[model samples]
Target: MADRPEVEISYDLERIDFERTSELIRASYWGEKRTDAINRRAFDHSACAAAFIDGQQVGFARAMTDYACFAYLCDVIVWPDKRGAGIGKKLVQAMLDHPDLAGIPAFSLRTSDAHSFYEAFGFEVSRDGMYMRFVR
Candidate 1:
């Protein structure tokens, strides 16, 4: 396999490719019914992270947070061709390390199939076993 290109993580909403992002999200199992308007509203309200390689977006994730108590991570997706190249990890890390989210008491996310992936980042299944959380 060829070496993966370096991934750049950015928090600037202006840098996000909304059209491509909406397409990818609408294709995802979790976001299949999501409309572009809804995505725009969500992104507008959340702290978003986008991953780029060679100036093209490869992955995206977002967090809803109050910057004091908690954060909820959502809409994590990597371009199919870019999977397994650590772009997703970088996106998640960027959200966690984002200045606004740092020191938050808890971070939570729901993933039907990516539990092991999130587990590596210290996320554990909650008592209800329906969501994963990382508590500070």
Candidate 2:
């Protein structure tokens, strides 16, 4: 098999490809009903991590954070053709490592089918309900 191209993860909103990011999110089970305007608003208010391969946007993830006490990770998606290539992991890591989010007390996310994926990053299934949490 050929080697995969390097994936570049960026937290700069200016680096995001809005159209492609919206398309990937809208295709996800969680964001299927989200409108372009809503997605744009969300990205505008959140800290985003966008992944690129050869300068083409391929994955995205964002965190709604107060940058103080808590953060909620959401809208994580990778282009269909790019899934399983570790781009998603890189995006999430970028979000977690982002200077704005460093040392936050808690982080949470909701994922119906990707529990194990998130778990690998230290997120645990919350006994409280559908959310998974990573507490520091």
Q: Model 1, poorest ten-residue lDDT window?
A: 127-136
Among residues 3 or more apart in sequence or in different chains, the pairs in candidate 1 whose N, CA or C atoms overlap within 3 Å are none
Candidate 2 lDDT, 1-136, residue by residue in tens:
7888899888889999999889878888898999999999999999899899999889889999998999999998888898888888898888888889988979999988889999999999988657999887
Query: Which stretches of model 1 miss by more than 4 angstroms?
Result: none
Measured on C-alpha atoms, candidate 1 has an lDDT of: 0.93
State, as a TM-score between 0 and 1, how close model 2 is to the true structure. Answer: 0.94
Estimate, for each residue in 15-127, the C-alpha lDDT of model 1 and write its tens digit.
99999999999999899999999999999999999999999999999998887899999999999999998999999889999988988979999988898999999999977
Give candidate 2 misplaced runs (Cα > 4 Å): none
User: How many clashes does the backbone of model 2 have?
Assistant: 0
Best by TM-score: 1
TM-scores, each model vs. reference: 0.95, 0.94
- The lDDT values for all models are 0.93, 0.90
What TM-score, to 2 decimals, does candidate 1 have? 0.95
